[model samples]
Target: MSFLDKMFASIGIGAAKVDTILANDRLVAGDEVNGRIVIQGGKIDQDVDDIYLKVMTSYEQEIDDKKVHKECVVGKFRLTERFTIKAKEKREVPFSFELPIDTPISYGKTRVWVETGLDIKNAIDPSDRDYIEVHPSPLMSKVFNAVTDLGFRLREVECEAAPFHARRRLPFVQEFEFVPTKGEFRGRLDELEIIFLETNRNYLELLIQVDRKARSIGGLLSEMLNLDETNLRLTITNDNAHNIKDMLYQVIKKYS
Candidate 1:
């Protein structure tokens, strides 16, 4: 017998097997995941002590000039079901659990994946990994579309490691980079970095970093603005080459 077979035999599992089945094939953050554990016994009866379920995620982190592996336990459960399995007998146990809302999107189309596993004592552990596509909230999509409609095209999107204090409920921040397509500030500015906070009460917080190009005389100027201000005003100009034409007009008009 192989070493694994010997180990299984020592655990009193002559030929035990474990399988997991989910009620739905797809899941989203904040959704309940329901499934069943199927256990098939071998030639000898075995006493099961405990069962455990764990949810894990694999992500990359930069450490000391190199990328390293980081695995986190998002969730875990200690099952209370205990029983004795007769020779050649089968048993099934049902389980239901909730997925956390703050789960990070790790795949395309804002999707996140979760790996679920069953730890069967004295036997080999069985696990399953699946993808969950996260649909952007209506408010989120609205704000995104609004920015695009304002002549800003998306240049890049990424998740930041640091948590921002402007809004709550986010352990990781998502940044969207855009280039101006029209208006007075077009070529004058490099790109805009935008961060969206949590959606609440039909409103969302937009954090913007405006990068200004260097002037011919050799000095560069950049500014950060908070979009939540009510009294803030800017003139809307139709200059196609200047992306921040409207902003510049407003500033110039205010000073004049």
Candidate 2:
């Protein structure tokens, strides 16, 4: 290539570009995502220090008392070590990694994606992105399904900024909100907001805040300010997964 061509390539113009190709974009948390990075060489050979991928998601973060969307890297992995890409050559590298058990599910207003970039010496790096649909783990789905079995309607689900009280691997947490339309909680509880702390092989942890409906003038004022709620801690095992409703009912009853 001509000197001019090399100079432009050094500045990232017409440089090697990368794209991630996943076997299947839709997957549940705790499952392995298999993909290959296809790198198409540009005008000149380039020495790459490394190629890496990051699992990213957007979260709500409060800044200056206002909420803003912030992109966060939930997990990362290096695809390869030092390598050289010959001019006009194309290369592919395969990779597989488990999505974190706590990875946020792709639901209303929530998104997940994989981003890839090359670490090159003395040259601008090239990057690519592939969005994915992440679903809940089997254990998490069972818990949510139990809520429905108990007649609680799934009202809303969203990725929210993690408050100080929430301890999580990511900066944000997803909350599933539900309202009991029929059952013991119908009149006593207004809604319940739950954050799945995590789901391990042995147990699942949940942080729940149950909101109560207003009874009188004083109660109404507290509800408006979001002050009338009961917080509960719950842990369920594989054994209890089958009877999650009963466990939830007992906990709600104690607060009710």
lDDT string, candidate 2, 173-252, tens digits: 89899998997778888888888887765578998888988888998998998788988889888877888878887877
TM-scores for candidates 1 onward, in order: 0.60, 0.92
Cα misplacement distance, residue 84 of candidate 2 (Å):
1.1
Instruction: Assess each prediction's global lDDT (C-alpha) against the native.
Output: 0.55, 0.86
* CA lDDT for candidate 2: 0.86
Tell me the number of clashing residue pairs for each predicted model. 10, 0
Task: Give the number of the best model, judged by lDDT.
Answer: 2
Candidate 2 Cα deviation (angstroms), residue 98: 1.6
Residue-level lDDT tens digits of model 1 in 1-256: 3666556655645765666677874655556878887778766555676666665554444679886655555567666566776767988878888766545444322335545444455665444566555544444555456556556678776654443554355444566677778765576656666665543324445555665654443332222342211222232222322444344344422421
> Which residue pairs clash in candidate 2?
none
Highest TM-score among the candidates is held by which one?
2
